[model samples]
Target: MTITIQQQFSINLNALLDEAGVPASGFGRSKHVATSMDVGVATAGKWLSGKQIPEYDRLERMKEWLGCSFDDLLGRTEARGGRIPARAENVLLNMVGTRSATRISICPDEPASIRSDGVYALPIEGDVMSPYVVDGDMVCFMPAMSAHTDGVYVIHVAERYIVRRVNLTTRGTVKLIAENARYEAEEVDLAEEVKRRNGVRIVGVVCARILVNR
Candidate 1:
């Protein structure tokens, strides 16, 4: 059966709080849920008990607290080749057109600056990148005209877009490395077809990942 965003959120929130070891007691539950969102403590209490659907503003606040993109938080699911929300697609498009310097950010506690300028909420479609990115992580990107010496990047091979690390050789050979030890890195010449295909585009280099960890 199809589930509404509220239902999905309630399920996910309960799961996250439980995993975080937050007790389901009245004060603990209210405080936990409220901290995750901007809702009032009383409202959170009501939400935890399913007394009512949260208002729109509260939901948006919850999205921010959970760090999931607006779409995923809204429980928009896709099966097979179904279309994703237009707004989500627009966010991806905007990321593509944004400038390079505007696309990167440093990760939490990392001295090195990370990329965040062009973050696309890609709905992962395959398990080729299992265990690292998982199936639902919204991978953000920073744009790069060429591969870095050693860093993960979004590369397009054929018409398929994949996320992998790029290892550039001094002689100009590029290797696509998958973090999952199961996948072997593919080495290719610098001027290969994958580098020039019309569909081959580097969405961006991963900057930071925001997932709902309760």
Candidate 2:
């Protein structure tokens, strides 16, 4: 028999709750989910009963709290031979323009250690990084306030977010290198930028890239 998405979600949620040691049926199950997701008990009950599915943000939160992927939560993917799917929260490049978060199932081959809660997925918007990380690719990163290593990172500066390979040079400056030769590398003084309130913030370090099929 074919199962609807709502039914699948209910089944998956119950299984996840059971795996987490919540009782199969009772106020405890709904209350636990409601508390964890910060929703009303009636809403949680609807989810538990297959009467409704959560919106995007709530679904993302549910997956994160349950330590599972979107596929796992929605019954899109199943474990085989003891291997679980990897997952990450999907965030947009322009945070100010859009404040939304969803979930994406990472490639199953991804290391199990990468399934941590700190991981996030950001879709590439332009060809600035090109050849290496082109437009349409989704890059996964770990949130970081400062650059501890010279590598590819997502940074917010001059009122925009950009992806670049950062190199900390002498004289309190950092060089932003674009993989594409068509673009020129730019160097900015970290202290001067901060003093000017340009807000040079290192958002995160890029750890994995999901390439788009040509």
Candidate 3:
């Protein structure tokens, strides 16, 4: 069976803490750890319980505090392939041209940085998201079927695919925002949009960007 992220983190963290002279029972002494990371004890507890995974920033703090190396915490090191084109002849096409390949570096043992695994590389098709991303930029993202947090996401609307920053509003609507100020932001009722014509669909959340040809 594939080792789960929770299992991996729990085992590694417990081992690392033990090496650092902290027993399993010490996991609950989250106040000290949280204070070091500048977060709340509750958040630290969540990390210990594997209920929540920290981003790279917090992961760095954990590594430094525990005096553990990345491989020590992750259980392994080295780059792993992410995705490739299905066709054999078009393999080259998948890496360049109007359609290009996205090189991925994945480490499954990690619980932090969804950017670490399950990613997709999509090409930028327009200048709406310019300044941050322009045409020909390859965006690395995690596929998300719905919006739950504020972040950059690939959206499908009017039969066209576009990238935008999606934010949740108190009014129970989502705002599709463009980085280029010239383009105006659009708000939609997700439920209603699903029922209407030429509506909105969230493709994925952008995690990283690989820019090329400016």
Candidate with best TM-score: 3
Each prediction's whole-model lDDT (CA): 0.50, 0.62, 0.58
lDDT of 1 by residue, 180-208 (tens): 45579888775665447443444456533
User: Which pairs in model 3 have colliding backbones?
Assistant: 94-101, 95-101
Model 1: ten consecutive residues of lowest lDDT? 105-114
- Residue range 1-214, candidate 3, lDDT tens digits: 2444654454455444433433122223366557777999788766654456678887898889888766555552122122211222222222211333355533222123335235566678777875455686566556567888666787767866688878799999999988666799999888888786678877666654553432
Report how far residue 145 has shifted in candidate 1, in Å. 2.2
Question: What lDDT is obtained when candidate 1 is compared to the true structure?
Answer: 0.50
| Per-residue C-alpha lDDT of model 2 across residues 1-214, encoded as one tens digit per residue | 3456876677567656644545323225677788889999889988876678999999999888989888777754344232322222212321211223355433232222334345566778877765445576666666566665566787777766678878888666788888655689988876666666556766766654544421
Question: How displaced is residue 11 in candidate 2, in Å?
Answer: 40
RMSD of each: 14.6, 17.7, 15.7
Ranking by TM-score: 3, 2, 1
Pairwise lDDT winner, candidates 1 and 3: 3
- The TM-scores, one per candidate, come to 0.42, 0.45, 0.46
What TM-score would candidate 3 get against the native?
A: 0.46
The parts of candidate 3 lying over 4 Å away from their true place are 1-118
- Point out where model 1 deviates above 4 Å: 1-117, 194-201, 212-214
